[model samples]
Target: MDTPLISASALLGASPAPLLLDCSFDLADAAAGEQAYVLGHLPGALYVHLDRDLSGAKTGMNGRHPLRTRDEYAAWMASVGIGPDREVVVYDRQAGMFAVRAWWVLRWMGHTRVALLDGGVDAWVRAGGSLATDVPVPKPVAITPAPAPAMPTLDAAAVLARLPGLRLLDARAPERYRGDVEPIDRVAGHIPGARNRFFKDNLQADGTFKPAAQLRAEYAPLVDGAAKGSVVVSCGSGVTACHDVLAMEVAGLGTATLYPGSWSEWSADPERPVEKSPAA
Candidate 1:
């Protein structure tokens, strides 16, 4: 249970079943996830929307998915029936891209008993688990926000102050990192010193995460010698970045800080330096 992931088979047989959260999402179609959930999902599982539920309202500079205040987040969790005592399981069909965001947020809320469903809903279906269309009513529970010793994060200014000494890992694709393409963010380049580590690199061809030892090895070059705390993971607006953070934890590399504003916030500011490879 030290790891942040739980297999579908293991979840299927657990006594006193844990709360299941289906975080399926499609970046291209925001409503597609809920539509999919209505069609079929794990029995008793509740749907958590990436934009509607997990993220805060976006201002011009706060990035697309701004961080919710701890108090506000605690209330949301409570409303969703998530309490300290609940052993929560989060999953999605998109290779954990969206599920990891929920997992990270829960951890940041100081709920250590939560974990991502390994390989997502597809894994469950492959394991002979059936999907249901019925949605269950969740009993709300009051939650007291505990101090999060595990999840650490940095704001834009803090990241700027840290500079070259801080190891910033951009979880976007290489093309985006190189300024060749930027389908979402206005800017096309990356933060001045950030290294690209595309979140998809953490997954296998089948969409499950790679083995721990292999992950540890693959992440070595990006992390370099920086201590886990000095390493900051980021993506478009901090969602996919959590995938990298989870990968690091799964590799036994300890918890890394998250740059929640990520590229969207950084690029919004003309004052910040943006880097890109030579024209290609």
Candidate 2:
């Protein structure tokens, strides 16, 4: 069986057809991603905004991009022409960062036919796949959404509960993890015991993810002897963390619980311990 990645060439010839979603987004510029999508995308790709569609309505300390309710997410999926058990191929700007959010959401909702466009839109264009400026019109679908709240998640308290036994992976840049630079979050540094593994490290020089064996090796140290539920994945606002989850799943490590609030919510509280210097 192939990995959860669908390459540009494979996408070009996908049988039974695959629903392509453009999940391009600039965290710095909220509107830029949508603007890029409106300019041009795959022939039949639909845009999935990180803020508007993929995430929930932010009320307070719930983090920047919280997961939406099952009903809301399913409705959005339907509007994008997603049917139950349909094949989906999500893409972003040549990197799997943002697109995997859609992939993770689908899997959380019990849709197993979801995959990502390896190397993303740039890979498609580079591979001679045509782009379309015209937006696609997909017929709205009506399907009962499957809710799996048990989809391996860690709440702010859950993280604290398992603090001693947990192996938390922080998917932020090294600088952010070291407290050398704080880009988007309120505070610098990371959860006291969490290890740093930049999500981009999962990709090759060409931006496609590393092969399964390599990824398995990369994760083996952290996952050894750990109960699957004890591994928590997190990042700034819980976005890029999915990239690591996707990579791990590709690596056959199975799925880890997502700390959706992540550092964003964790840091907001003064009680949680924050560590600045890197581990010895």
Candidate 3:
């Protein structure tokens, strides 16, 4: 697929339609996503919790939302009726913030046929799609694991070693990037030599992504003549960083490595260096 996003209208009209997953989540309120899903969601869509379903156990050192092992992830995908042949669609209320995490994970686990629902639940409503409160039970299926990961990833140690040589893109808010505010992680600053891109910048006023050409133009400078592979995208707890990865793919810029540990894992270690921008 050229882009990892599917428009609401296109989704609604698709034949042999793909399975829909509601990945809505709130960092502050852990149970909000399920609550929202129970209240209303797209017809035949299943809910996937960010903390419970998407992430593995947190050990304070593995970052807040660490990834599960390949075997574990594959098992979960089977339980959700996702397999190599399944075409999946994921979405959330926060513009693709939480949904793209699932999107990235599926790709990481070697499932290639997946896409984010553009504009999320709001877009569905706007497209005249009605909500269904009933949750469907997904039939379990055997999943075939791929030999290699389709999505690339990096840990804190790898990121640290690369340092100033690689282009590190911080997908956090400007304040967090500048150490002005940090409501979640322990430390307020970002990794040294990383540039702030704010994942939301890739979206338009309507919450849908901008045109591919525009995204390419805005992100081209950030790459700075480096190959796309040399660029790494990160955010607090490694969730929002996938938004940038998806945007880069949508922009036809190829994929960038994901720093799954991100700031949460980096800041937990005092020995790791942190950089704070000058106060404005």
Candidate 4:
């Protein structure tokens, strides 16, 4: 896969500069996240709210952070000056977690030109890029997002039907995956047939992603004999799971379908089986 990662240095002084987005958010304190962005962010960067700009109204089984309608998202993009030809670069302070959400969301809306700022906003500062408290205003540009009945998504029933070969990967922490401690969702365990692969494993110690080859090697065994499209990526509320999907794309493993109705939705259904492991 062609890399969708942009290096901080490469982005510096880029001609026809990309649309910079700050996507940092605290799951617990939504207001604080936006405040953090207002305090200091990349010059000319616009702030994207995780709960507002990136998500849609939640219907009964739509899961938390359900994706907004394609048309609605397109309008939002236009209002923010995003168009098909724009080079959009999204970043966050939290090791690409929230940023990748933006990346996946854009792709889901049929814009493949969006890229993630490698290692996120922190990397920018480390590369000597300065933060600006001022936000830039740009003229709105209209775009027509391609039509799709829905994003490539897997429901809980579909996941259960996939059975033993499905390769359902859970992006939660080991403790949460093993049912030791679930900080967010109501349930402490994971989907019955899911395997634990913390989203952070895709990155290096410096908060940057591991090289493509390394990522490929890391994921090969876990996905052994499974069709690339057969693998389903998921997490508590379908957020960090995008991180795994992004890593797979970077590794050239091909795209994995997302289970937007992740553990949060899965656990809500009493009929769905939950699994806990002594070893996560």
Candidate 5:
């Protein structure tokens, strides 16, 4: 199935083939998921929280948020009644922050038939779509865990070994990238040989993604003359980095692999070098 933004009207009626997911989450507020869902959500949408559903136990020194295992994610999907053939549509409160993470996870697990809701729930409401306060409890569907693809990922050793060939794309704000300000992690700065590309840059003023042609033009110079697959994306803790990956996909560029550890893991080890300037 081709990736296309689905409308709230299309999802209101019975859509057995389509799975509508409301991936609304706020990192600061843990109760944001149910609060947002309770206020009013797209009709017949299932809620998926980033911290509760998408992540696993935070083992110290590993990362701030580690991804759940494949089996875990598959079980959660099955419990939420997502089947392999279902055309999934994910949306979040803001543009596509949390929704894009779900999109990337599906892609990593080898599911290609998924799309983000353009402009998200706000757009749906503006388009005269219906909303419901009550959450729908769906019957569990059996799902087989698909094998995750062995895309190019890098550890500190691998990054050090191929520093020249691999272009690390840091999907953090310019301030955080430059060690000017860090509100989350303990240490500031970025991985060595990494370039900053704030994830928000991929979106328009209205929170929707820019056109494919515009996105292509913006990213072409960055990956120009590089090998078929040379870009690796990382963020504070691997969540927002998927935004960059999705943008690259929309731009018609080859899929960029994610560094799930990101800065959270990279900074844990003082032995690994961190750079404050672009030259670093």
Candidate 6:
């Protein structure tokens, strides 16, 4: 299928066979997503909240927003009228932040025919597409999410086992990764033997992802000489880390595994070693 970047104009012209989802959310403001949907959004677009719709409940130990089960996600998709045949287009108000999470979730659930709205809502407005104040109420359609393959993933035990060979890529900011400041999670610092690669670096100034060749060059040094499936990706939670995974796909690197527990889950356990300094 086409790479997951769809232009605003192209989305505007597409027929209703394609499902458009508005994934606008603010982690700080819990109510902003629904409120924004109520005020205005793309015509015929359905709203998906990052906290409520996309993620599972947060226990003290599980990562900030761990992915919901496949059955749960499939039920959500069905309730939102997403069928197997529809082309799902997801967008967020802020430069592809929350939307990319939805894109990743869809992919994780074994749905490959999804795309992100290039430049997101800003680009849609700039393209002069008409908006709607009336919220859409979609009739539910039955959807069966296929079972996902057992791709490379790491639990605490698995992570401990492969620490020597696996390179853990932490996608948080350098400050967050360095344990200098942490505003969200209870603990500071990062996983031992992890390297920082801030997720924002995946995008250009215009909010579009960098070209595949450029992305490959940037990530080549990191994965060089490692076996085909040696790299593991993690982040503050499991959200923004998907941006790195998406970038890797764009770069033509095979899909890397997600450490869904991430730093939040790792730090919760006193046994998991934390590192303050950058890996040498």
Top model number, lDDT:
3
lDDT by residue (tens digit), candidate 1, 79-169: 8898778999999989899999999999998888998988998889998999998888978997777565458999999988888677889
Q: Mind giving the per-residue lDDT tens digits that candidate 2 earns over 149-232?
A: 635787898888877657889999989998998988889999878888889999999998899999999988878887655578
How much RMSD separates candidate 3 from the native structure? 1.1
Model 3 C-alpha lDDT per residue in residues 171-256, reported as the tens digit of each score: 99999999999998999999999998999999999999999999999998899788857789999989999999999989888899
lDDT string, candidate 4, 1-280, tens digits? 1467888998886888889889999899888778999999999999999999998898656677887778888888898888878889999999888988888888888777888999887889999999999878866986676567334788778888876567889999899999999887777898877888899999999999999999999999889888876688999888999999989888998888899879888888778788999971
lDDT at residue 259 of model 1 (Cα atoms): 93
Off by over 4 Å in 4: 149-151
Clashing pairs in 5: none
lDDT digits (tens) for residues 1-280 of candidate 5: 4644455555444356467788888878878866888889887788888888877888766677677788888888788877777778889887887888888777666667788887899878777877888888976889866675634556656776776667888998899999998898878999887888889999888787888899989887777776656688999988889888888877888778888879998888888888897434
* lDDT agreement with native, every candidate: 0.89, 0.86, 0.91, 0.86, 0.79, 0.82
Best by TM-score: 3
TM match of model 2 to true structure: 0.95
* TM-scores of the models, in the order given: 0.96, 0.95, 0.97, 0.95, 0.92, 0.93
Error of 2 at 154 (Å): 1.1
Name model 1 segments beyond 4 Å from true.
146-150, 278-280
Minimum summed lDDT over a 10-residue window in model 3 is located at: 142-151
lDDT of 5 at 46: 87
For candidate 4, the TM-score is 0.95
CA displacement after TM-score superposition, residue 155 of candidate 6 (Å): 2.8
Model 3 lDDT on a 0 to 1 scale: 0.91
Clashing pairs in 6: none
Residue 221 in candidate 2 has what lDDT? Answer: 86
Show how many residue pairs clash in every candidate, following the order shown.
Answer: 0, 0, 0, 0, 0, 0
